[model samples]
Target chain A: AQTVTQSQPEMSVQEAETVTLSCTYDTSENNYYLFWYKQPPSRQMILVIRQEAYKQQNATENRFSVNFQKAAKSFSLKISDSQLGDTAMYFCAFNMNRDDKIIFGKGTRLHILP
Target chain B: NAGVTQTPKFRILKIGQSMTLQCTQDMNHNYMYWYRQDPGMGLKLIYYSVGAGITDKGEVPNGYNVSRSTTEDFPLRLELAAPSQTSVYFCASRPRQGDYGYTFGSGTRLTVV
Candidate 1:
């Protein structure tokens, strides 16, 4: 069984600043996928960014990027130039390369302050 | 495109009542999943289907049942509803093998009183 952990239950960042949400997981599979999903008040889950374990270079999408340390079992999400729309419940998820099941973390409620 | 659609955006049920949460996808995805999200918490998988006529249990399948009659439709049924069953349910679909992310529905807010 794989478990994803987001230590921070809640975090706040000032507008136009950068913020990082920490995530760690326990998995024995050599190849897997890590993802960060955002859910706003609308309760719609939106994919933020994803990282493949085999890739050494971190994945960057617009202002969202990930710091994946496979050896340390850590995958953190970084939001640069944060905006108010970035405020949401962020979840870290994990799934094996061949598995259809995705394990999710408790989530961190992020608030972007203006 | 209506990627994923879940009916009855909000539903309330009494104890011992039974109801089905309808989910349908237009992407013709082979993999579909049902998950529940408690207030201020993350999501827990209830069940999943790899394709039509194939379904399996997930982390939290108790008090729930699911049937996959087609590649685009996966419905979750709850029998004898309890207060503990009150949560937001989500349906998602994705390709069996791909780097693509799952497309989630807006979710159904279910309240069991």
Candidate 2:
């Protein structure tokens, strides 16, 4: 079974600053996919960024980027030039290439202080 | 694209009551999933379907049933509602082959009293 863990339950970042949300997962498969999702107060889950296990370069989406360390089983999300809109519940997810199931972590409540 | 659509955005049910949470997707995706989100528990998979006529239980499938009779619809049924079942349910769909992220619905908030 694959399990994702987000150690930081709550995090806060000042506007225009940078913040990183930590995430770790346990998986035996070498080839898989990792994802970061954001859920605002509106309750819609949006994909922030994604990283492929075989890709060494981390994934970057505008102000959202990921630090994917496959060896450490760590996939952290970094928000650069953070804005108030970045405040939300962030989730880390894992999915194997061979399976249809995607496992999600508990989530990190992030607040962008203005 | 309409993506994934879940009906009855909000619902309240009494104990022992039964109801169905409807889900449909227009992307013609072959895979659909049902998940429940709690305050601190994140999202737990309740059921999943690879395609029409093929369904399987996920991490937490107790007290719930699902049927994927068509490619677009995957409905979840609750036989006897309980307080523990109170949570926000989300329906998601993804392509059968690819690394594309799943498209999630707005979610259905169900409160079991």
Candidate 3:
């Protein structure tokens, strides 16, 4: 079974500061996809970024990016120039290539202080 | 696109009561799913359907039931609601074949008293 572990349960940083949320997963398969999702106080789930296991270059979406270390089984999200809107519960998810099931980590509560 | 819609944005049910959480999508997606998020926790899969008339249990389907009568609608039913079932439920959908993540609903918060 694949399991995702998010080491940081909660974090706080001043607005305009950069923050990174760490995530690790256990999987035997080589071909898979990693994802970072954001859930604000509204409780709406939004996909922040996605990274393919075979791709060496990490995925970047505006201010959000992922450091996908496939060999290390680590996928972390970095928010550059973080803003108040970046405050949310971020989740790290995994899905095997072409598989319907996507496993998720507990999530890291990130707060951007002003 | 109204991607996915879950009804009763919030609800309160008493013990042993039964109710269904309605979910529907406008994207014509072939796969639909139900997941529950306990307070300050990750989402857990409750049930999923590949298409109309094809439904399967997910990780935590113990107190839940689901049916997919049409490609657009997948409703999750809770029998004899319990405090443990008091969580926010989200419905999501995706195309049958692709790594294109999931389109999720705003979520329905259910409180079982």
State residue A105's C-alpha deviation in candidate 2, in Å.
0.8
Residue-wise C-alpha lDDT for candidate 1, range A1-114, written one tens digit per residue: 788999999999899999999999998989888899999888899999988899999999999999999999999999999999998999998888888877889999999999
Residue pairs with backbone overlap in model 1 = none
Quality class of the docking in candidate 2, CAPRI style: medium
lDDT of 2 by residue, A36-67 (tens): 99999999999989888999998999988899
Error of 3 at B93 (Å): 0.9
- Model 3 alpha-carbon miss at residue A85, Å: 0.7
Q: Which candidate is the best by DockQ?
A: 2
How far is B50's C-alpha from truth in model 1 (Å)? 0.6
Ten-residue stretch with the least lDDT total in model 3 chain B? B94-103
Where model 3 places Cα greater than 4 Å from the true spot, the runs are: none
TM-score list, all predictions: 0.97, 0.97, 0.97
lDDT per residue as tens, model 3, A62-87: 88888888889999999999999999
| lDDT of predicted model 2 | 0.93
Candidate 2: where are CA atoms >4 Å away? none
How high is the TM-score of chain B in model 1?
0.97
**lDDT (Cα atoms) of all candidates against the true structure:** 0.93, 0.93, 0.92
Candidate 3: lDDT of B17?
A: 99
B30-50: candidate 1 lDDT, tens digit per residue? 999999999998998999999
Worst 10 residues of 1 chain B by lDDT: B94-103
